[model samples]
Target: MPMDRRSVLKGASGIAAASTLSGCLGFLGGGGGGGNQGDAMLWHAMTESETETFEESLSIYNDENDAEIVAEENGDLRNNVETTLPTGDGPEMYRWAQDWAGNHYQRDFLYDASDDIDFNLEDTFSQAAVQAITVGADDAVVGLPVGGETVTLLYNKDMVDSPPETYAEMESTMEEYHDPSNGQYGLSHPIDAYFVSAWMHAFGGYYFQVNEDGEGVTGLDLDETKRGMEFVRDSIWPYVPADTNPGPQQAIFQNGSAPFAVNGPWSIATFEDNGINVGVTSFPTVDGNTPSPYTGTSMWYFTTRMADDEDRRESALDYAKWISQSEERQRAYADAHSDVPVLNSISAEDLGDQVAGFKGSYEGGIAMPNHPKMGSVWTPTEDAMNAVLQDDADIDSRFDEAAETVRSNWEE
Candidate 1:
């Protein structure tokens, strides 16, 4: 819900990739013009395989509509959209966060495709996806739902026979497999707010208090959060590397040195390409319940600038309709990336075992809050997480300080 990237720094790979890819794709070099007469431009930050899948799917739309649907990689898409849309920039449509749709709507940067795209909104996507993309009382559609990603347990099947159901089992398994000398560890994940939220939520902790309207956020939940923090300090830290940045953890997992990891579907192709037998399942349970990981929905928005150019707007809507409404294109995209399609019409059975595992993992998860207030919690929480993992840490005091910081940020 934050208006900027800092809040989502650690986990905003799709957005981050867009910023980097924008440069690589020469958009930063000022080569491509804002969308013109012939091309209906799209900018997305999808991973390599997802990009490949999406581009192939675009071919279907392009051929049928007699349109050139060009999807270029943009690393800083959210920011780029913010700066350029009002100025009538190129991308008639671009992929972005479902949660951020409201922010864009409030800024009047997005076009409401509620009537333009021909489909039963209620019958197509899950209620959550619909809710994420809708804004205000009339609930206009600011974003078209594509697919979503959730953090789940990805274990090397040849290393672990079955996924552990409880934290105790996971600990024992970690102890069994974790041999750091040969570049192996029980678990691999950056101990940041985005990744740790799963453990916290399972312990009945939350980042912010949601208001009655559910559109706003209030103060922090410090006490329950401390309980989760205690587990992180006493349990998870010992099993992971001392320097567990995301890059190294992924490298360790890719090397097959570590059997278990907590990641999204983005890594599935990489592991498979490396010939590792990967197994997917829900995040391990704490107490008797599965911890809720944050779910990030990928959505495409029709820009307001496109509305003036009727031709491009029609083409953009057609492209959105083709990918989102067409079962064949949706299934192909989902199958290609092993991702959970946001469309309710696409059954889990059709998504194969691996993607279905991610879907099952996400059932307990909460959608990441889209409100601007969410921005206040991330930095303080991430700092607290890092501090608590230290050897000379004071858990309660650190958490209390962090909670106070969030409260202060909210007050500001």
Candidate 2:
């Protein structure tokens, strides 16, 4: 089975538990600072390798600049931030997905550092990265984008001579290799909204779009969305396993039973570790239209607590800029975590072939909306998809219900 994000986080949390116990003992023995009081604290839930690389970079920063920045690993990071940040008692800075920027800023938990940050946004990061962290009426820059990730076409080089360039060719390959009795498949990908977004985008459908009044509106009921759903049901569903979970889908590809899979960089190491010769490429075109997956950036966000203290805020900004802007640090992230470096100076070639292959997909991808309403779209969309694909429910009606549910959820 593929080691997905949840499994990785669970493992990291165990390691963090041991480290936290050690810190607690030290604090009790007089070698201590009590709980984010005197020094700047950075809360993150990075994987083990990523945490190691970040700690190395941070140690250098601390030694060279006389800064007292402490990194803390949190198991339930998002929930902890939402709960503690409003009380103004959390860390000065936290690392999270860029999609949370608008929600956090709207709740008065974020610090807008647009004017205070030293570097220019346009000149520093990719356009998608910049857009992901920009929010609100005045277009406040809420966070510093450090890395990006997106789904792409991953295939087994031993099975496929060359990846298909068009949907028709891909469908033909699926037909040739699909054998349900033997547990073999041509293609494998989770049936979740995020994984299937590329298909919807190729059919000119979108999940949520900002309206004239800067409000997010759901596109679940759109005709294009129905068409996209129908295409997946009729064309792709027949070849894939009935189990829509990512584990089963990914196992098919990892075990060499499937030639191609749609996944992100997180799954790359597992595939290679399993001895499958993996190759990354952009999605096949659909009737001359390229499929666009949703792209997300992970960034360091400054909290309202930091903004209240001048010294802390300055230190936080300096650390954020140094870590985000340094090409060497960004390269370390790319090498260690398979993160797509957001720095404009770091090209895909500088990282490796995997990063290079994902470049086209990332370029053509859509930056995921950072609006708070985007949170309401996910469950309804996934539920509707499951109904239509698993239970053979009517796609149009299910999507209409989903659209209504999304609107109702957002209103609440």
Say which candidate scores most in TM-score. 2
Model 2 segments beyond 4 Å from truth?
1-34, 37-39
Local error of candidate 2 at residue 270 (angstroms): 1.2
Separately for all candidates shown, the number of backbone clashes (residues 3 or more apart, or on different chains) is: 10, 0
- Judge candidate 2 at residue 295 and give its lDDT: 82
TM-score of each: 0.85, 0.90
- Residue 138, model 2, lDDT: 82
List clashing residue pairs in candidate 1. 1-370, 1-371, 18-74, 18-75, 18-76, 19-75, 19-76, 20-75, 34-90, 35-90
On the 0 to 100 scale, the lDDT of residue 175 in model 1 is 91
lDDT by residue (42-101, candidate 2, tens digit) is 888765556678799999999999888887877667667888887768888888767778
Collision count of model 1: 10
